[model samples]
Target: MRPIVVLLTVLSTLIFPGRAEAATTFGPREAGVNAWPYHDGGQLPKKYTGVVDNQGVRMFVHPGITGGRKMNHPVAQAQYGLALVNNYRRTHDSWYLDLAQRQARRLADTHVDARGAWYFPYRFDFPLSSGIGLTMRAPWYSAMAQGQATSLFIRLAKATGSAEWRRAADRAFRSLQLGYAAGVPWATHRDAAGRLWLEEYPGPNPATSARVLNGHIFAIYGVWDYWNVTRSPAAAAIFSEATRTVYTYLLRGFRNPSWASSYSLRGDVPSEKYHNIHVNQLLHLHALSGQPVFAAMAEILHGDFTMARVTATIRFSGGTHVGVAFRSTTDGRVRARRGLTLGRASSAPVDQRRRIGGQPGFWYHVTKGALAGFWVQEFPGRRSTTGPIATFPYLTRRTAVLAKGSHLVYRASGPSVARVSATSEAGIVRLGWVDGRRAVLVSAGSLRGLWLVVTPRTTFRIAEGDDHDEVICGVSCERVAPLG
Candidate 1:
């Protein structure tokens, strides 16, 4: 009977392989746009108009700071720039490209030092403090920011034929590479052995400790990008060494087969539970690197350290810090219980938990009464109460439509979120309400032979495709309906 069930599952996947094609969209919906109640510039209530100057060059919504100045940290600046570059690639809008260029210039002028090694202010609040000063030259900074900047500049140079951008990217990569000492990159010069170090001293020491995993992972990611852009054998070798070293340490120091534990190199027992978004990014890196052990570790972390079960409490007044815990569950559903506090840090914890149900994915507070986003699909099977899921949230006024056919296009007026199922078998897609409007389309594929249902409330329309054999429907929800 078990073998029969397995065979049926395999046959279903083969007949309807939804995994072949990439999703129409990827990444978190609320990314770049500030969902928090903070005053970040780009996250303002206004419509996103391609990172305007008035909106500021930095993507973070914080006021008073403009251009890359708004982003004191090299990592933050790189992430913001990367987001802009990605947006430009998707939309082909020159504004995003221009914004990335401006930020890159600012980074080159302000962050890159006389030593040709790029370093950034560790924190926006700390001016010329020692902690900040030391981190400015940290190898972790180079590892995270340089590759992103290089990738962005390379793309920009090609797009606009700007030699300056190309040169700047080359300089940045060379500077970052120069920061490495011996096989192990120093987390801080304040220490010998070139071990990992943390900038936020007296709080949590990340250097020379196993906690270097976070920085190590970022370093690997940057090296990967460097290899992609330059195709340099040196970059490839660096990537390989970094991956091997981190994996060796992670497995030896953190792995606990019994608990399926893969901690943040903190070595403490409960510290393993705190592994949030970093674990996911590492999993992605492992998958990209083609390392079986890293990939296997990723799976274990995902299965055991479920983020859905965890809840966060954040106080962003002075600076951001959060505590996380796995939500206690009774029957398979998360109980509406208070979240456990995991402590705080400088920034919001990364949201790494896979989605479940037809709900969107997020790590912060969800406005319960307010309609935000909904979940659409789960991969590998029709649906598992527990598994990897995708969600689409329409935060703006624009409406979206997911056509019915196997080959369907989901659309949004501006930047919208669409969740594609991980697998094609019994895949489901969802859209959030936009002033009470909805639309749906259908396609004719083998997967269509199975009965598929889409429920839309408020206003809707049906568009016939080719013949009667193909039909699509559109719906709108104004009065508010429960999304499950």
Candidate 2:
């Protein structure tokens, strides 16, 4: 019976590809977990500690599925490679390293086309299709998937000093940098403005030729990462040019201080969702480049109150220094209610006993929910907020603020309170505990700077870093009093 199911899965992957459901013959009971989320057979390997960074909390791979469901989504396959690398970094585990190499080879060999185009079916036929990039929203080979896969290959090459991976990375990089001959009229094209934009799909009018903000951002970030590691001149040129293109598009189209979920290459925002995806993406871009424009764009997109909508206010049992960060939309509407009782972060903030219940909604999890650890420590609800809010540097320590035309993105840690002082622009917000060195980047409106802080919630400390020298006033901070 098991062999039959496995055979079916392999056949489905080759034939239908993205339209097939995962095989459910493999059970979570074998993996020692009670009930699995998403794909049934998938499990967090027992050895995984779920600690942040240098290790993934969960593996979306399912034993019953061909390529363990990673092949179902292009980004997932690449991220799996990342997880493999991260696990190796933490445990010095040879198993993970070997698995990563094998995974990379399979993906490149099976999916990649002659023109370096990856046959990425962005939509999956799974139950949670609506929430994720299902419904066949975009084209087969999206910038997000290609860019991420390229980065994964490059990273693998750097890690193992393998020429095959490097060659693979180069091919994908070319397809991304220069539009591939997708072999169909509408497969790839350029907009009237003469800017190159990949076909999101081979169907329909608008969907056929378009660009997604997050997709472009992800690809650009991946290119940047590749350049950072290898310092390849070709990779660097592509990264620089792509960054400029995205920056220009964002400034012109997303200037309303809010954004539609995605926009076409012709600069038409198809539809708008009340979400923080744009904010998070911009924040990530800012983190990568430290460019004021990206920070400014983040400040604008931060007004989308999706983060507030996902937040469930839970009380802490012990005396832990906690803070709540809020973001509002352009219409002066705040999504967060002042005091709603929901779940709580563990007073023993260090304890990882309380796992979030069930899988978060696909869109929520990708845009904001995945980064919930950086905001809250833990909670019982599938969507809960209950920890130090480290969304932004300027207001990292604020308990609450009237989020009007402003968005807040933060990551917090530690149970005890500590006095942290940066430039004047960098407010005196009560941050959660810090195990070691954590650098904080603060930006409220035009004020932006990197500050000397302690370590990330869970990370190894590095050498000493420099501190900023300027000071400025606070914008919307709540807690001005110090903790006793």
**Top TM-score model:** 2
The top-ranked prediction according to lDDT is 2
* Candidate 1 local lDDT, 390-484, one digit each (tens): 22321122112233323322333321333444322232222211111222222233332222233321111111111001111210111222222
Q: Output the TM-score of candidate 2.
A: 0.50
Model 1 ranges with Cα > 4 A deviation: 1-55, 59-71, 121-142, 179-211, 255-276, 309-484
RMSDs, each prediction? 15.8, 17.9
**CA lDDT of each candidate?**
0.38, 0.41
Model 2 error, position 484 (Å): 32
For 1-484, candidate 2 gives per-residue lDDT tens digits of 1223433432333233223212211100111111111112232252543222233322344454334453345666666666676666556778777766755765685564544444444433331121223234333456666777777788778778899888888776666655534342223334555444434332334334346555666676567666666677776566555554555565455433223334443345423442345655654554454343344344434322223332323333433332222242223232332222324533212212111112111111212221333323232222233443324432112112111232233334422233323212232322221221123343342323222233211111010121111111111111222110
lDDT of 1 at 271: 36
Question: lDDT of model 2 at residue 289?
Answer: 45
